[model samples]
Target: MSRLTITLDDQLHRALKETAARQRRSIGSIIEESLRLRGIRTYDSAMEIVSKARAAAGLEPDEALELAVREVRQLRREKKT
Candidate 1:
């Protein structure tokens, strides 16, 4: 595990703490989940996901890459809306 030091506004800090307490989860976990939900993945993790999707769909490498790119772009657009 790695340690991180982040500066948050007083209100946001309080809210995060409260939410963590309510959910019975550590604040770090909540923050990690938020980051993952927002598509902020490490390179290895992203590759793992792509590999799994390709295997499941029986796609060729290039075809899988193209499909993954298109789906990611569509997801980003949907998130923006």
Candidate 2:
């Protein structure tokens, strides 16, 4: 395990502490979850995820690529709203 030190503004720090207490989780866990939600992933990790999804769906490379493109476009449209 590694340790990280981040400087947060007083308000943000307080909010994070309170959220952690309320959720019964460590501050590190909350921050890690936030990072994951924001798509901070390595290329190898992302590829593994894609590989698993492709296998599960039984999709060929081209079909997986097309589906991925469509899903990305749809997410973009939804995010714009």
- Tens-digit lDDT track for model 1 on 1-81? 999999999999999999999999999999998887677778887688679879999999888878877877788777777
Q: For candidate 2, give the lDDT.
A: 0.79
Give the root-mean-square deviation of each candidate in angstroms: 2.7, 3.9
lDDT of 2 by residue, 11-75 (tens): 99999999999999999999998776555677887567567668889998777767765665676
Q: Give the Å error, residue 8, model 1.
A: 0.8
Output the lDDT of residue 10, model 2. 100
- For each candidate, the alpha-carbon lDDT, in order, equals 0.87, 0.79
Which candidate number would show the highest TM-score if scored against the true structure?
1
Alpha-carbon RMSD, candidate 1: 2.7
Residue 73 Cα positional deviation in candidate 1, in Å, after optimal superposition? 3.1
In model 1, where is the ten-residue run with the lowest total lDDT? Answer: 72-81
